[model samples]
Target: MSIGVSANRLELLQIARAVAAEKSIDETIVIEAIEEAIQKAARSRYGAENDIRAKIDPKTGELSLTRNMTVVEEVENESQELTLADAQKIDKTAEIGTVFSDELPPIEFGRVASQTAKQVITQKVREAERQRQFDEYKDRVGEIVNGIVKRVEYGNVIIDLGRAEGIIRRADGIPRENLQNNERVRAYIYDVREEVRGPQIFLSRAHPDFMAALFAQEVPEVYEGIIEIPSVARDPGSRAKIAVISNDGSIDPVGACVGMRGSRVQAVVSELAGEKIDIIPWSDDPATFIVNALQPAEVAKVVLDEEDQRIEVVVPDEQLSLAIGRRGQNVRLASQLTGWSIDILTEEEESERRQKEFAERTQLFIAALDVDEVIAQLLATEGFTDVEEIAYVDLGEIAVIEGFDEDTAEEIQARARDYLERLAAEQDAKRIELGVEDAVLEVEGVDLAMAVKFGENDVKTVDDLAGLVTDDLRGWFETKNGERVREPGILEEFNLSAEDAEMMIMRARVAAGWISEEDLPQPEVDETEAELDAEDAFDVSNMDLAELEAEAEALGLDLDEAAEAEKEAE
Candidate 1:
């Protein structure tokens, strides 16, 4: 106590110190208590209209108060209105708006105001303490704490977490998990806040971090340096995919976390209300890695394209349905686990895909046998819309089209052998070149003329021979005119027992950068149809511009004039 302060001031100082030490109250509470006490003392004697105010030196226990008043035209109530005479006693030049306060009675006044002052002081101290608690706890978010369920009230469960009471709203509680009063529960402190009732703490049993916390408790390998959890994705209370990696070569991270008979994972899953847990081994190679992400479903093949961060999974025909899981859960979890987009397909679909693809390649190379509008347009590209056009169309004429050059046109034409002799020689060389047995001769019901023609065209491999248009192949054999030989005929011609051709084309397209492996779409029969149609639409086939130019020149037509005519035709 200060020398000027009475015994009452010393007692108030002791009380302020006790409240300040309560952890919930800071020095603000002490100052507020003293100020309130002094204000109560000033108001008691001077009347409430006096506009009494107070300030207390909390460290020294010194109290001071002023009776606030206005200098009016004439004083009405002496308690709140100061006259020019009263104001001039404190200040000689008291103006119309000036105020003055006289020091009130000291020692006796202090003793008389003690009780009312104490009540006001205690009330202010409580308010400051509540604010302090609200401020202190609000910063401790995302922490795990143990609490006893006090009671469920108004759709919220009040938890006594020892240090403070927290409210677990109904939304944060897992369904069917009954929490009774006095029962101990572990929850994540999701949010600590200030409510009208003071500090409002929010606890959660349904947060994803709750499941993570459970694993941290049950899996020692995860807590230790042996296993590192890279990411956790969950559909809380349903299923979750956790990607984990082994820090040490000797440690099997997935196996360690799974435990014997899945005891370790089962424990965490039980804590999360039977939520399914998928423990996947993390991978550096996204393709091989995605294969591991969608677990419990056998993946036949994984095709990955890194540029798009996509992965395509080919599952066995029987496992396709499971690989995608109920509502696509398997693939969904796989996507979450690898952070990559994924597509799932079956073996049979992939097979039919290859068959359709082989037929298209065959059609692309059979330029001479087919002279339809679209084929004519493509053929016109090489200045060879038909067989007759090819005999005279020169290299420069071929280069005039979009992507063709003299060398490319020659290569295309050389590859497009329509005669039986050329077909046979090419097939013989292809057979020796690929080191595959020549089985086309043994194809039952196949004519000797057709077989000879196939050999002449160097169609040794199923894919190479499959490279001819059905109409052109028909033209070569002269068995049937303009009849299309599609997949069935090509399969028969090559004696192919399996449809491995689709996978091959996909691999080729991927290698060629036409389609990324990760973003492989479901194989479609019309994959090449649009490109073929676009080629057909361009009127470059068989119409050798050079020959047209020569004929026009004979008629005295200029090169520029011919080009203008061609553009107008287009």
Candidate 2:
């Protein structure tokens, strides 16, 4: 930091080159920063209002310093602007808008001036370096990067990544994994952000993709896109499960990821601080995938509820604890990997539950149809859950039941119909007694049972129903005390899907005059009209250059200027 810049031309160029090389920025950026610094110091040495400028030749290291003034009609501030009379004294050809330049001697940097110049240069260089880092790493997200751990402050690791720095926050680091200063580490670049402090490179060792990237490194097939890892679930630093599928029919995805004697997965495990890895072959069938995800345990049967995306898996009595894993970790990882809610039960438990359901259904049929226990048991065993099903089922379905003739089936159907009529009358009475209006029933999809349920929930009229949202009828999840809990909806027991609830609410809104049917979103468009509109659209591509130019001229548009700008853009 001496003031011999003009005398030492080689030193000035060397400093600029070194700073640019070290910061990984363009050499021109370093030169501009130096120019700004010199300009600042020169302004402070001369009057601050003087419009001083400085430039340096990159190759020859030649320096130029000048104070510039603009000629104005009237004298503004004398430092930077002068009247035409004063301008003509300096330059004979000066016009009103002409600029005049006067050469100035090199700045002799004082103590304060030198400090201020250093600050300006440092700030500009730092800004350029930050921008370079952001530009370099912005598109590098989702890739693994290697860096040396710089320091650990309050459990956050700062890494020196050669040209820049990155951080692995406490939450993003593997739990209980110790990272020491100067230690080499590999992390996934999950995010790169331009922040006030600089570019923040957020690295993560706990991200599931970290394991996937490690596999790509260790397995050549994965790296070459021959094998695909569709999903990964990790308990970071403890255990993980990855689902893999092979594009090549002959090669096994699991075997490729496992390598010879598990060397491939072991390498990833070592990097993750000895986390156990389960490599399972992925299947298009979710049940097969879930069964595979829960490694070291066998599932006896899996009943999938596709609508709700839930699967109930029944295991042998001995495999209950194993299937659930230690502290539910096995089932939890399986659920995450398959993207489904899984309910696990032992064989004995499932059998007991089935018997309980059968008994309840039998009792329901007996009470509703006023039939003998034998007939009711026959109906329940044949999968009849309600009187409604029996009343409308084919005559042959019940007549074919053991020891039942067509006459007995007819009698049963009559009883079922009579029972339903009586039930509907009682529910209507309950609905009216609960203050539910007849207008509510007029709304499409609203039956007596639903109206009664609405009245019980204080929704008595069509207007009241119209004011409700989908979540009010389909139930919603809430975060309560650190756990996700399901809050019961008004029609929770009705098993309404979100679309069904929304349709009912919209119908109510129309009946209640809250919204017209036409006001609702029309998701469907007539295909014939859509095709005609497409065919009728005017496309500029059909016009030749001359025709297009004539059209633009007709509209008073300058095609030549636009064509020049378009050429420049190209």
Candidate 3:
């Protein structure tokens, strides 16, 4: 108990306790601190050139320092190493690589070494205690915690959570929220990590769960099983989308979350410093679910492309801005939450959009034409704006309008029939470009399934069908559009009819020079214009009827002959 003391045991123990207390440490930590302190003292007092060690019993008030010497064949450094014989004198079984120690006389530490030891021991003990503190707090991730504002540094707020300190990064702090040192505030444990200095705790006041938790605290239904929060997507400090389902049929999820006069959600809003939250109903149907996700804006219709996972929403023009949100944030969040690509448009926008679409279609129709704009415009005026429509029109109907005879109408229809052929040839050309298998297009008025079958049949071009006679064409047309012969209907189901079909064939015949101009529509001459031109050039007033008829007959002009005087000489 009374080994002649250098520094007072009471003073050393008191300093160790103080270091441990500063970090809320345990007894073993204090004992380790005591051992480190004594080790420092012995090193400075007796030369560090000599091997020495110190130990303090954790339960008992005991301290000891002894000189330890390694056993060797011969003494190399007389100050540190002892010969094997001498080592065995201390410990009979001492061998090479084994250390033997002997009790040493108590010694005093010098002023400088003593002071240095104090600082070194205090630093080591503080570092040990800090590790212990970090270890204790590391397991608290994902939990709400109460901490006091400690200090602010470089846009980071340091908080003193009761057991450890945490950092609230600038981004995690609520904007414009005041923090006073020592003021208590609650935050969620956003992260827990370790650094060289100590454990790192991250606190956040702007996390989405922060809002949910705030709601749970304020709203009874949300806190209970009556209202369940199914999913949440958020942009901290701006807006968030939360989907809720209700278990109790009587409770409305939105109404319950909103509470009386918006009190429940308003409380959460206040806690989040006015971060807007949209609560939407969760649905098993994705389309319905997306509709809910896009809220406060009414959606007119939702078209979901299941294969692409895309949702095209048609909304009223006034609601487009709302549905898209400011800078498209609303739809972006909705897309993220619903796991679908969203395209939102107003009703008017959709209409204008369709018009542009049809216009493009009409242009494509015109480009496929073998005729002039007059015919294209005429066909469009009759609502045949696409090549498919023209190809399927009957030649009889075509002969009724545009004043084309059967032969010319058939010729026109034949050219219009080339659309599908061209399309198939294009696909085949692309296949050739890709160095894939050679492909061909097949056209039939078959239903979708049968059309696909026909496409596989290699009936690629209208030119291919030109060899087919009228009877074969009739058979194909009937199989495709399900139209009966000569039916009275407002509009034909087939893009082309049998009469139009004949016109297409005849038109092909004309272009091949197989038919004459007389076989086509001739330009009708205006009698009035011809007569006027004749009167301007010739003095027909003095000509006799016989002379006029003879001259008209010779000139290839149809003359209007009146009672005329005889032309005597000539």
Candidate 4:
């Protein structure tokens, strides 16, 4: 079947089938392309004013050309529309809005017509190819694919992945790995997206999941799910760590991943250009997992700050360099694999830090509770860092402390309570002196210290506090160079939960009258303040009751009419 000028039969179906097979697209798409090209050429050969149509038989490749006219009540255009009186000559029952078709003779393929048809077919085929490429590769994302390096441009490698070309940008390739034309590479398909040109397949050899996929290929146990590779952290071609756990107790996950004489791991290593891998056993306990992640180093102890998701690993002085790796790579990869921030310390450093914490806590107890060094040290050793714990702990707990009798425990508790009260009173006075409004202080959960901090920042009114978000309040105490910085949110001294901070803001809103008390849990009023209000006199010498009510309305206050009745009785 020839596709050329001066041929009796173009064999369009055969040509479409051949092109579809070469381009890896559907045959119907190619047939439509041919029909569109023929239609365009027919419009050019015939008058451009005529409505030309073209169709090709799918099986025989026979071409048909015709002219179509719309039947209208009045013929608006002589070339495209015909009145029903003229349409009835072609068909007796022809009505308005009906299309009339008139068969035309086969188009003679002249030089200009053939050129136009060729260009149209080429354009249609290119568009169909782009659509096909987009559809084919869009769902292949996140899979490991093998491709041949086709070209390199400005540190980017273009890979030919059989049906489509993929790009591995310089940042997505392993560091220091060089590629040549036709070099076979295995990379993870990180993204497949359609753009103006076509679908772009983005490949990455530096992705951490790429290393895990390679292991899954090398280890049958990982592939079969007997041993699970839960997490992987990679430094590209330099090093990586994988945490693996075994569902079956008999099979060792690390041993199975290592294979016989390290053959399986060695295969993956070769593929990754000798990237060293540490296969660590996964554990539910974060401390144990972190200890395992920092392998080849003798860790003496691991202290986990669970709130911060940080781990402090203390090792022998000799193992400090090993635990930190070359330029801290080991600790960095371990932190990534375990999803924790790691701090490596020598045993001597850990001991020194412990002693410093002990001294700080003892000094805090001594200063806050006015206790002697002996009692402060005892409380600090018992893990009481502040006076709050001593003030609020159960009496029995203090009594059970070694060398403490019931009377002595009571004395210590009373002293702690007194100190806290005095400190709070001092802070309250300072907050008032700094011009903090009573409405701001009335908001529940914001202590005197926090109120003083707010006053220092000029957030002195309930409206100001209500306008703030949780983050604004959380950043109140952060400091830089002895001045508040507002970058770090709520340091350990604040002791504010996210919920508590948000609730404080809501309380401020209620106090500011921006929202009603019915919108949230009402704050408890002090009993002493309520009694004092009951005893106070309501003197109306300065203004009448109506004027008082107007002033209260302006201040968003509710005046009790019953209290007015009591004042009248008096």
- On TM-score, the leading prediction is 2
Question: Which runs of model 4 end up more than 4 angstroms from their true locations?
Answer: 1-6, 47-49, 72-79, 83-86, 108-113, 369-375, 394-415, 433-436, 456-487, 502-570
Cα lDDT tens digits for candidate 1, 1-570: 212235466566676787787645776667777776767666776677677877666767766666678888788987678777777787888988986666655544454466666688777876776676667677777677888999999778999877568888988987777889899888888887676767788888877677666777788877775787877777667788888898899989888888999999998887777888888788887776788877788988777756336667788998987888888777877776777778888888877866565445445436444434453455644334244345345656655566567776675445444443465577666655555335444433333444554555665444454344443332222224532223233333433322243443344345445567785446567958866755543232345877876756765668666566556546
Would you list the C-alpha lDDT of every candidate in the order shown? 0.67, 0.89, 0.69, 0.85
Which model is ahead, 2 or 3, in terms of lDDT?
Answer: 2
What stretches of model 3 exceed 4 Å from their correct place? 1-7, 72-86, 219-226, 234-239, 247-251, 260-263, 305-309, 326-329, 332-341, 365-570
Summed backbone clashes in each candidate are: 23, 0, 22, 0
Candidate 3 least-lDDT 10 residues: 561-570
Q: After superposition, how far is residue 391 of candidate 3 from its true place, in Å?
A: 12
Give lDDT for model 4.
0.85
- For model 2, what is the C-alpha lDDT against the true structure? 0.89
Candidate 3 lDDT, 324-388, residue by residue in tens: 99988899889867777788888888889777866665566567866766665566656665676
Instruction: Answer with 2 or 4, whichever has the higher lDDT.
Output: 2
What does candidate 4 score on TM? 0.80
